[model samples]
Target: MAVQSPSLDDPRVLVDTPAAIVDAIPPYAPRSEREAEFYALGDGQMLLNIGPHHPATHGVLRIVLKIEGERIVDLDPVLGYLHRGVEKLAENADYHHSIAYTDPLEYVSSLFNELAPVMAFERLLDLRVPRRAEYLRVLSCELLRVSSHILFMGFMALDMGGLTPILYSFIERDEMVDMLAALTGQRMLFNYMRIGGVNGDLNHEFLSRLGDWMSRAGRQAEAISTLLNENEIFVKRTRGLGAISRGQALNLGLTGPNLRACGVPFDVRRAHPYSVYPELDFDVVTADEGDTYARYLVRVEEIKQSIRIIDQVLHEMPDGPVMARIPRRITPPPGRAWAAIESPRGQYGCYAMSDGTDQPYRFRIHDPSFVNLQALVPILPGCLIADTMAVNASLDPIMGGVDK
Candidate 1:
């Protein structure tokens, strides 16, 4: 025979239940601290840990979400899993030698990373790059942007459960990588830019092959756009999901496509013209809807614009020295300067402090992805679990850029 435990409200029963009986009963603990706090604060919430290894977390990003049923009460992003003290490392490396380090900071757009540091060094040294070199840098950077976006398009499709686009996009990406390798002798980490100018020049045959490849790539991009852009499912999934208002985006310091998607035509290439961008004729694409779909559209349009820029650069490319006249052992007078470039992801800036030595006294990188990740906390709430991955993939925050 067993005795039933008295209810707590029943004052007649002193001992509510035996220890064994209590142990046998299910524990009455709150599901989570958030749930307990929700009840305490009268907010009625629970906590959910999204991912540190999720495919859509954009590489090791973890989010702590306080949810009231399906609605989010609060969002906390956990980062630092990929931090490698790159800024600290830059301080110790020579200004010219530091180009190798910046390449991996944003591995997806390594060329632009190299450009920022080299451009800053050029500015610090007051070096004038030849017209041909400037044109080459523009051509390479624009093509690199398209290549980076190609990877994004592929991976974003993969995240959305479509594998065919990945293979198709990679076909173009492989060609671009091959071209980059032909020029710089390395595929991904080109280390192509130096303090004063580029490491090499575009030969006649290489340019001709690139011209043919560009025509093919343009056709491929159109096919991709047709396949994904008009699909009803892709549109439905992306439209109005993770929408960020212009006010919210501006307040968060969002730039590049993220900001442009909010209908602000603020592109560093256009607004703050660097390299040969001022001479190039291209439209700054913007969309009224600041959602995942809008970001997708912006990147798609950007690839077309990059193609146009590359074509123009190729046609107008002149013959001259690729490297500016600078001492082999670069050691600028003690000074500090900032240089920003339109990277594939956004406006990437490099702030360097030189101590009149071969190495820098301090080196800091203003990675656009780090600031863009801040927008996640605000937009992530009120989105479904599946949409979380879509939103993250759409933002395209590179973890190496974020963590560094």
Candidate 2:
């Protein structure tokens, strides 16, 4: 009938008492099994609402945590605060203009977000992409991958209570953005990749900046790695926290750095080579320890791999037209096509169907954030409130992509 709530600051709650707590609190009626279970909390357990507005994702992600003092008992992740019906909007625009609609889905890695649809449309039209254009696509996507990962590293550390990492990360990330802006005409939502080819070629200003940045990019990355790889606070907070086993990663259907951190070599680029990735020389980085620390380390190594990829792309970039010769108005025969890319988050995919019209009959996307966010429900249970934040950042689910 009555109970005293446990204090997180007190040591008594950390250990089990002879009489365990159960079902001493009551509230609103159940909506679903998950909500019913959450509502039926053990004695002393209380529900904590994290946010309908949080920064880990660009827009909003709400998390309802059931906690007994400081330790999390279970959590319910709420999404869909930033969905803009991007796929529905694409169905109305012509092929050339439809690429613009995909830009905002994954704002941090906008180029790859645009590329999947472009490739899918290319498939629908049976268009042959230029050789040089393929290389440029790889180059831009790799750079975007690094930038996205850099933002992840900074914010992941920030979530774990490190301010310096974010500041240092932005300094390097801004330079890469400037280089991309030179090539793509704008910094954020590029809309550069066309159905057959890309919007532009490697220009003088972009190349000049790329060469300079390439010279020290490796060293800059090394410096940041050195800064975080062994810092006592960083290591202590993340080393064994929020660990995902190899089986868990696969069973949860995770991909990208999150899955790779669990030691599965299932990169969409390597597993199913598309674009110019087959031509590039780089190893698929993985870690045996699939914890929050491993996730962070995997992305750091990926930055190096991306840098190597960019260098090779620069040296081997061939001379040719970046845009394919296609009519301004695209009206493909009735057909359906699908294309998937290894986005910073995970496997970013798009499926398009054309019914002999300028616009797609149906356009749909599979954003990795949506799939990857499911892992949190399984992984966050025993974590402390602070550890939950760190784990969320380590997984790096962008609300823009997840909600879209």
Candidate 3:
């Protein structure tokens, strides 16, 4: 009689066979001090895996949760599920073409991705962008900011079991995307900004579309806000749910809206003064609560501020060439340059190193999501398993940027 194999559920039954290889028991062992400390569970405590694939964790992030009863004891976020070696690819490409590689880093706000590298390369080459070009950059970035914030509102609600807000978001978001497509040919990964300027100038079609959008964008946003902001369930679910204190936010290196929500008011635009932001008139939006609800409110208020910026750009946009006089092959001097911009999520920065070559010796990106995701490690503890997604969605990190 042939011996029977162990049950598939029995992970301890290791076998040196092809069938077992397909469905084998993978043994667990601690690889580092952090892992050893986190996995050290006591009686009645268990480890619950959230996702490299769950919707709540968002965009291929694996979070191992240590829970005792209904309360969360600790969590370890396992990253790199979406890493594509973006920096290595940029280092290999020439400076003229290198801007394209950063587009997918924060795919939702590709214009800002292009802006950082373009600004950094301009520094190395010692080039001044045309006045019109600077204004155009601000206009495009502010528009992208509003679009990203609108998407954030939808996702946060959907994560909390509200489906209608996402539908409204898609409706409003598609209109804004179409306006961008009028300016740049691509809808998603737009490699529009070049070394010293944008790929194309604003045309009549783009202007017409933008005008139509401006007329209705604010009204549309308010309509969706009513569905969420006043709802008793939404208010109760999010308010004070994940209160990230100012001290905690600063310690974890949180930036963008997450930082501003905690009453920090540290925007790259206002503090560092990049591009044409100094010329524009707008206030940095902030909230004092430092919780999930406040994060949502901060983004909502920012939408209005971005619209105000766009109005100023349209009125003050000067006449000149959008692109500066630059060579076909850009070769910067032997030095390093850094550029940072206020993106939809936060401060998107790029560091370019040159050794007298058309290609950068080293290209480093400082993505906001990578630093902001740390907020969860400190904020998630002591919250219930049910409140996980509500808190995560409020942070609004793009996994593409985080993994890159």
* Top TM-score model: 3
All candidates: TM-score: 0.88, 0.91, 0.94
Reference-based lDDT, each prediction:
0.83, 0.86, 0.87
Candidate numbers sorted by lDDT from highest down: 3, 2, 1
Local accuracy of candidate 3 as per-residue lDDT tens digits, 285-378:
9998999999999999999999999999999999999899898987888999999988878888999899998889999999998888888888
Best-performing candidate as measured by lDDT: 3
> On a 0 to 100 scale, what is the lDDT of residue 116 in model 1?
87
lDDT of 1 by residue, 164-251 (tens): 8888788888888888888888989999988767889986656776978966767777777787998888888999999999988899
Per-residue accuracy of model 2 over 1-404 as CA lDDT, tens digit each: 77978887777766644222322223457778877777676888887777776655345888878898999999888777887888778888888787898898888899988999999989988889999999999999998888888888888877777788788788878988899999999999988898889889888999899889887876666766787999999999999988899998999999999999999988999999999888889989999899999999999999999998988998998998988899889999999999999998889999999999899999999999888889989998988987878888888888888988
Task: Name the 10 consecutive residues with the lowest summed lDDT in model 2.
Answer: 18-27
Candidates in descending TM-score order? 3, 2, 1
- Sequence-dependent TM-score of model 2: 0.91
Measured with C-alpha atoms, the lDDT of residue 19 in candidate 3 is: 51
* Model 3 alpha-carbon drift over 4 Å, by segment: 1-29
Clashes of each: 0, 1, 1
